[model samples]
Target: MNQNSKISEDTIDLKELFFSLIAQWKIIALCVILSLICAMLYLRVTSDIYSVDAMVQLEESKGAASAALLGDLSKVTGGFGQKSPVDAEIEILRSRMVLGQVIHNLNLNLIVKDNSSGIMDKFLSQGRSRLTYQHDAVTFTNKQNSLIIKQLTIPEYYSDKPLILEFKDSNHFTFTYKDQVVFNGKLNQKNTSETNKGLWAVDINAQGELLKQSYTVSKLALPTAVKNFNAIYGVSEKGKMTGVIGLSYLGQDPEQITQILNNVLTVYHQQNIERKSLESKQTLVFLEKQLPELRKQLEDSEIKFNQFREKYKTVDVNAESELLLKQNIDLEKLKIELQQKQAELSAKYTNDHPLIRQIDAQISEINKKIADLNNRLTQLPETQRLYLQLYRDVKVNTELYTSLLNSYQQLKIANAGEIGNVRIIDTAVEPVHPIKPKKLIVLILSIFMGGFIGVLIALIRNLFQTGVKDSAQIENEFDLPVYATVPRSPIQETRMSILKKKKSIPILAVKHSDDIAIESLRSIRTAIHFALSSAKNNIIMISGPAPEVGKSFVSTNLATIFAQSNKRVLLIDADMRRGYMHKYFNLEVTPGLSELLSQQVSLEHVLHKTNVENLDVISRGKSPTNPSEMLSSTFFKELLETLSPLYDHIIIDTPPVLAVTDGIIISQYAGVNLMIARYAKSQMKELELSVNRFEQAGVKVNGFILNDIQRSSAGGGYNYAYAYTAQKDN
Candidate 1:
């Protein structure tokens, strides 16, 4: 059978996973409680902040007619110009020019705090000298001398008390209540060989005052101090898509925050309007210059047209006809002259030549124009009608000029009437509540983050552990049956109560508790027996991937169960390295498995009785060098062979297979090898490797024992409870 087929296919049991987490519910609860406490403390310590907001809107400067004019101009030139109104307005709002205005007007640097009050400022005060010196001098052989001096000065702001000077050596100096001091020292020695230089020294009084008066030099120093304070700025938080804009400020005084925000908003609005008005004024100036020029051009065009009409007033039909005939004649003459030039050029050069083609084309165009002029004159009613049309053209020209002048004047007037482009949409108001440091949200988020991180850590740790965890994982990977599952008993304190109350002949007869986990183990035991089928000498060797997976516990309990059924059973503590079966059996560890394996004693001599009937245990006798080699020896095999025939069932508790290969070596002699995997403790890879090692060593790993399964529901342990209750009633 395939590995996967050995275990039934079932959906992931979410309840089981949840139960595993629930078992560690204390950790989860602790994380949540701690997070809530921290959040509460944070809320209490944080200062509340208030906010205000202001709004501005941009309107298009030009009306619809200007838009139409621009469109028409684009069509005429086949070129695009200027952004649409909305895009231009958005750019204007974000422009550096507007922001710079806001910054300069508000002096934002002075308003925003870059640093808090520093530690040095708090402890150190102005004008106070902390330096100390001595009042004695020492002379050296090289003529270098040093004098000890002491200086202590208080701030000038001290009131009522006159300054006093105290010296460490009372005989060195005396001081008066007035700002004066008397120095007592050895007199200066005058040098006869060379001129002596005067001594220079400094003195300080107790009132933090310094005085130096001399004919050659004088010096006085005073301390000047300024208090350090924190600068503040407003801040606000608003939702991403919310129309509301929040504003807040921080300062030593609450009223200062309010005043700053109010002034900033007022300046922002005024500046926005002023910028628009300036642009409108610039446009008006350009229009004003253009309007006067257009008007002058219109008047000049009308005057010229009037003069032409008045000068040509002499109208005669015959004379006008003669003039028209003469003009047509002049056109024909010019066409003939052009043709003559072309004919001459073509004869001297090829038609493809530039000069020849230019001459020929020019001649052709002139001949067509002459022909068109002759046809128009023939179609006309008479010369008198032609004269009348010329007179009407002059009148039409004058009228068009007058209309253009009137339109220019009107557009100029409209441009001068323009207003600011931006308007105030809303004004900032004082916010009712703070927009930040949300206590409830912070607590909830902290709890979620803690739990998420905890689960991640648990899973990562579980993945890396090299031990067995569950029977299903082993059976699916190794094609093995699960022989049994053992629930972990509560610590000894709880088990002692049950033991004392039962007072039974066989401790095994003291019914196991009906906890949900225990009931699940009964189901596992049934499955194991079914897998055994027809195998003879149902001896089971229980071991794990590592130490402390409850292998000893499983072996003892299984053996006890068999004995309770009236079948002979032996529970052997085969772990020589660290065995504790003697303690469980209430017997000495001497003369046990090690003595028998070494041929120092017989197996019967080492076997001991527990409080239960029909069950015996062989505790690890003593420590031995190289337990693996001893367990793998022929004598051990012989011992197992002798015991197997005598007992109905032999349950051996061996050390973890992976930790020491002795379990795999011993399993070869046992009829059934059952691996014990502790839930949430053993890893999947180690279990697979252990099984592979057993298979390679030619040991038949019959099944696994899944131990310490946590129970999530009350129904889970019901069967175990029912069995115990039925036994009690019987």
Candidate 2:
């Protein structure tokens, strides 16, 4: 039964914790709203950027097959093979040779102003003037000046001489020779350099048709505005490499952007083809050098074989020489067997095989035998010899030379047929959609980041908070019982404020509402009765660790509760620095404690009646320089002793113990000292320090009065009241 009750109590405490968080709902809501607003503002001002992509497919080079054959031959000769087509193409695409040609063909260095109209359009076009004349003479006029040209020609006799020119306004004329000013007066001529001469002159002889040409140049030079235009390539999705080549301008001109991209693409394609063609030309040059050498070797071998046959004396020997015929037949049979063995050995083993070894030994023995026969034949004279070996050597060399010559011819033909290994399977097309500035993705990420930051800030602020926000925190930290809780009173606005603005108050005081401050005081009153019922005296000391924490208010109100029961109750303001009971009761602070302690005035003279029946207050009296010393005096002790017999319950309001030692000293005189802690205002450390001070002074604390508890389950609500009542009845 006891265990069940204990579990029920823990659950109630947990509910109180949740209720305390509900009390701070306004702060949490404000944080969420502000975070959302900031996120939206960031999304509004940011600009969206777009990206476009194009795909280009590259094909493998056709020359790779022939190159592979040549590579095999080189490998046999212990040399390196040719590079693959893909590797060569990658370098060709990135080469500066291709990029440079693209730049030049596009006229990338030329700076042409966009024809689109903008803020500076009028000013840029201001000085431009066009004029046509029947003869050579023309006149130019503007607001500031006017010039009359008698004639204008190019590369004539007057081009070498300085021509006099005049500029006229309403008041005066300025004379100039060529473009240099000679004087501001009438008809002044000045010598000018040949370079300074303008393209204006006169000629007496004229052609039948008037020369018509308009030499257009900018009248004024403006600052150069340069924009970098380049193509960027990177890998994209779908397992293919892509490129986004963009052209942009700072001064809002869409037409120029289109023209630039069009020109760049045209030039880029031309350069790419030209680069591939160059590689093909290089391959052709290499084939041209090697073809003739192979052909000459083939022809020389054939001529050598014909000459050897003519020089050698060899005739047919049939039945006349039977032994020689038998030897020739055996040689023919051995040659065929050797060939069959070689064919089989070629499939089974390398050159170092046992069959090759046996064939070499047999060939050496046969050559020796042939040499011996030839020597014998030479001894027998030229007519007797019929065998020949020179023709056989020539035949083998001729056959090998012919095969090599044929291969060389085939290589030349192959090289001529070679095309570029790489070809564009697909060209880049115009993109239909932009690829960047995803609005939905950015908004979602921003919201998440904002919420994360809000939580981080809240947690950091919560860490530094030292006040007792909930009763659970106090019980968990100090291991103390929460006696009672009082609900907070409704804030009252002044009548002048209400009358002038007619603003209605949001909340009003009620008899049975879950107000935090009121609920806390009622709990404290119940604790007092229970504590005093077990003690000898009902005298209680109400004190806190800090000022302005509702200590004095709680003391006065608690006295009023006891006095309402028709019990004599005395409320004393023991705080010397800012005792507020006298002011609250609209009475004088002087001639109270100070006069009574000095024995100049009686205790009855200092005790003032409040508006409430049976309730009286003893003010702190005049401000004293030495409050701690006066609070610890023997006279103050005797006063408390005198008041003890007069009132049924005497509630003393003392200054915060942390601020001074007056509260601690006064607590020693009172029968029971009840420490008051304001909810969400008093810190746990301050409470511990106050309790420690009392213990060090050899004074026992009656218990703690948890003031300003939020009117919730966690703050000991109706269930707590029922428990207290049950305990009292028992």
Best by lDDT: 1
Tens-digit lDDT string for candidate 2 (276-353): 344334433443443465456446655765665466644554343445434543554344334333432344357797
Query: Which ranges in model 1 have alpha carbons more than 4 Å from their true place?
Result: 1-46, 54-108, 111-254, 265-432, 451-479, 485-512, 520-539, 566-568, 583-588, 599-605, 632-648, 678-699, 710-730
TM match of model 1 to true structure = 0.47
Of the candidates shown, which would achieve the greatest TM-score relative to the real structure? 2
Question: What TM-score goes with each of the models?
Answer: 0.47, 0.50
